[model samples]
Target: MPTTPISPPPIDRTGRWLASLTQWVLAHKRLVAVAWLVLTLAGFYGSAKVTGALDENFTMPNSASTVTNERIVSRFDSGGGTPPLVAVVTLPPGTTASAPAVRADLRALEQDLARAVPGARIASFGSTSEPAYVSDDGRTTFAVLHPPSSVVGDNGPSGSEIDEETVARAAQAAADARVGGAEVRLTGNALLTSEAAGESGPAFLSETLLAGVGALIVLVFVFASALALVPLLMAIVSIPVTLLAVWGLTALTEVNIVVVFLVSLIGLGVAIDYALLVVMRWREERERGLSNEQAIVHAAGTAGRAVLFSGTTVAIGLLAALVLPVPFLRSMGIGGLLIPLASVAVALTLLPVVLATVGPFADARRLRRTDRAERHWAAWARLVIRHRIAATLAGAALLVALCVAAQGILLGSPEARSLGGTGAPKAALQQLERSGIGAAPLAPVEVLTPADRAADTAARLAAVDGVRAASAPEGAWRADGQAVVEVLTRSDTNSQAGRATIGALRDAAATLPATTIGGSTAQTIDFVDAVYGSFPLMLALISIVTFVLLARAFRSIVLPAKAIAMNLLSVFATWGVMTLVWQHGVGTELLFGVGPDGAVQAWAPVIVFAFIYGLSMDYEVFILARMREEYDRTGSTDEAVVRGMAGTGRLVTSAALIVFLAFASMATAGDRDLQVLATGLAAGVLLDALVVRSLLVPATVSWLGRWNWWMPERGRRLLRLPAVTPATES
Candidate 1:
């Protein structure tokens, strides 16, 4: 019997277009380089100006909590979703709040505080005589100042624009002047969030530089030559250009502050990854005896096409966030969408030019070791293929275990202990905790009701389970036929019990005419419901679209199905890691110096799913695209597995390490949410590259044999592709 001859691989319009574009870029390398240099400079300038434009607000439009908050702000001119700043006053020793002189002093201090913080509605034992405002010892009295929500400037209505330091200072000054021998400190949700924001992790610039250094080290090790610098150069151009786009986006709509860190770190990782792919392919072409220009074009045609597909997949994952109702999440989606697009642009245009010009000089200084990585990876791939059943079983078992672990993830606000901060806010929080007055005052449920029904509402709420106290203040809390009844729960609102309490309160209030619950806690619940209520839709959209995209890119139904399944496993495993580390406190204290938050941040999972799904799929594309190409060239499944792993194993792992370093640097952020987010990203990338790409993908492909290349004629027509003949069929 005679062996059949292998046919040439099919080239699609995208590959041909990329080839032409690469030729164009090569002909105008100097112009392309100068244009990127100018864009980088503009991006640096834009990054500086963009911070002021970023919004920190989290808003859910048209929800009950939102409408009630708007009503409260409009009518009472205070207390509309923003947490009230608490002024904790410790009187001179042995002076009870009931004493005439102490009462007089308290009343005087209240008046002074009202004057000190303009547009602040003051509620205290002195003003309401509610008794709940005083500690059991009676020596500590507290005041709640509901600041005007309208004070928030054009930055968007999350109340982040309020000058927290100035407010704290003015309140302290009032306490010192009016209440002799008394100490007062300020703490609130707003103050704590502000302090956390003020606390620096590694500086953004330092973190970026650190990530760059780490990436360079990995690149150096991978290439063992000066060619390593090409990827870094691409990253340098990509990050700034993305930032510049973000700044322009800010002018059109609100961009979240978190996008800055994302653009810096994720942009660095993605840009470098794209460049690494193109450069590696170019070098491989050169090693095959192609001219420098031919290498650039061939690399562009192959790896360039993969980069485009990978970037589109990333953008598609982020696009799911746009369907969410929350404003900040939508902004995040928009900002994150820019990262991959900018990276793709740089990789396709500027990267080819850099390789054509600087690449030869860089590649001239060759490493002593040649083909060692490929040989090692080829050996590993053979071993995996030889034991395909065992490899498949082990990988599946690990992923299933992680998926089981993820079922326990709790979604809510971070625990109080995890909101680490220093100075006056910390001191005040400590003081309040010590005084036996729990955090109820910080997250009280504000009931908006008719003035005539205010007292009735408070009385009914007080009798409900989990209710610690309820007070309907007469003076400042009432305006325009609306009365505010503040209800305190026995548990902190950030806790599970507190969330249940809030649900109960809403249930109880549902029967009352013209009554609704609104506060920071209520808004948090609304936010969770809004973002997650539509989560299934977002997940479906991402899944279907990604499957279709991958099916087209890989030109096979089985391959795309396997890719999606592996990507999901990678993501869920990442979530499981987060739950164990952050929620269960398995290694949180040892690693991050924080206790279990008892829950992951409410917004983290969705963002993680969106990002990790796409990012991990990058490795899938890198590996399988090569496998497909190899299969086309050799018409042998076993050869495809070995050669594909040999081609991409080092590149995939190196790219993953660079991305991991970027996220690891982000984990140093003071905010717990950022820490969790970064941990998820890093874990997901590492897991996908090392396990999914290395072992599971090869084993499964080898097990599937020639079925990996099967594409139905109808599917090929849908993608506008040539009909496929299985590699095994010749």
Candidate 2:
């Protein structure tokens, strides 16, 4: 009789490589530890040098806004090279701003403000020849100011001291308070922008601290010993290294200030997450009576591989954002990608060495309370598997409901009225609107034409349906062979009606030779075009590439496809929640200290998608990889699902909380965009962990049974993955 041939052992190249790395780390633990410390020191030095290079200004090359910006720098004489800022003083109730007494007081106030701020050029009511400076009602009058140095020059911070926007509004407010007859308000694009950007420094520090504290509490609860400190140590080593890499990138191109916060906060959470997974696996191995070296090697072979794949998934998602033309989004992509790369480096190399040498001491003090809830994950897994259809249906229904809300999302840029602050900038804008001389002129749909046609262009723009006023102001310069006509709109620059006005102006100006429209409205239009222009392509590429990678990673077609679908659903749901709470004011007043103004920031949806897609996949990879491994060993899909959930549930929940708290910290920034970013991320993490991974994933896996792990021979060959003989259901 012919003997049954035994199949050769399945290829395990990744596991073997990881095991070798772990052994090497164990052999040179001391040297590895020292090297990481030295690298960390260098990272700190690089981070300090980078702080001065961070910039908030974003330039979209070749876009209408960029061309407009160039034109302004070359032609505008009023506000130095900077955009004009308006300071208005509303006369008490019935008094007119043009009255002799009111005019005299305004002139004195302007003089006082000029003195208070060095290099200020203020055109007070009595000094300026421009009719726009005073409202027709005479109830409101304003002054235009610009920094003397900023005019005719463009520069960013480059030295030990970072450059800051001049706070002329503060000085003007003080002067108004001192003079006391009229109500003084400073509202302009410059001042309002400064208020929003000014909070980054303090916000960064606060978010970082809060996230760290929250993570620390969770880590302590999870490990219940000195072992809790290891993840933090990894984070301490990871952040500076990531920042240094970003600083190096800045040498080649511009990097946004927001990237620094992302590196500090998100990087910290990701670093700890990688470390926690590895350490927990190592502890499990040790509990099975393995030697320290053996445990480290085993943990590296299993959990380290998961961390590597997970980091790669996240990095791929972030780097995909580079496909967008927007510089700010690109910077965030590159910088966000660096976080995982640097964190993975620490987790794979330095973490193993640390654990090999110091882990036992920390593990000695295990949890004394012996909480039974920690062991309940296995039971939860059994219950879910027993009622898989119910769990799957309920989860799908909830996710679908949430996604329906995304249908109502309205995208637009933020406006002062909706920024939710009591600062001088907000007050000033309010006063300007109340006085019927709001900053509409400051955000006109600029029409650039041949100098000869400037008059004709202005006349045409003025005739547009939404045009409030249009002028080819006298004395405007034309160094670039173009004349500028400012077309003011009746609606706010970021409003729907305002955007419609921009379209109408463009249509009206289309007949004019050499005409181009540029201004706030133009910028908004360009931004939307750039984002959506390639968004569908970007989304397809990311999805296809992610699916291919996951297929190779888990060696299953159905699982990877399901994972992609589930992740996309999670993203849509998160966007819906964001739209409801932020754009629609569902909880704006109670949660964010401001009311919704009918639109979400234009960039928010794309930014959140890039982040949440990758992050949601993180939990998917973590949980499903374990189940895959268990299934391979047991040849029973049901057993694998239950065992995987029992082994990974606590780790997944804690990791999710760590990241959620980190994002939630962004709410402390007090900016609408930041809050939206925070909300999307926090909500995505919670939903993915508790509902998607915990309920949907297991239920679906159980329902699919053996098909969950099936891979055809042709497909396995195509992907160059190991082949496995089919096993019958247990």
| Best of the candidates, TM-score | 1
Candidate 2 differs from the real structure by a C-alpha RMSD in angstroms, to one decimal, of 5.4
326 Cα displacement, candidate 2 (Å):
2.3
How well does candidate 2 score on lDDT at residue 664?
87
Which regions of candidate 1 fall more than 4 Å away from where they truly are? 1-13, 89-102, 134-141, 150-162, 170-185, 190-198, 421-437
What does candidate 2's lDDT look like per residue over 1-730, in tens digits? 2212222223267766877776777677778889988989989998888868866765456786557645654564323114445667666667776667666776676676666555554555554333445667776777655444342222211101112435554444544552228666665555554454323434577778889999999999988899999999999999998888988999888888888878888887799989998998888878888777777777888888888888888898888889999887888898899999888889999998888668999889887642354468878888999999999999999999989999877776555466544576677777777767655644556666788777788778878887666656444334456666666677776677788888888777777787878765576677788887989888888888888888888889999999999999999999888888877789878876576756777777887898888888888888888898888888899999988988889999999999998998877876555777888888988989999999999999999999998888898999998767776669
Encode model 1's per-residue lDDT on 482-561: one tens digit a residue.
Answer: 99999888777778888899999999999888999998778778888988899989988988998898888888888998
Scored by CA lDDT, what does every candidate get?
Answer: 0.82, 0.75
User: Which candidate comes out best when scored by lDDT?
Assistant: 1
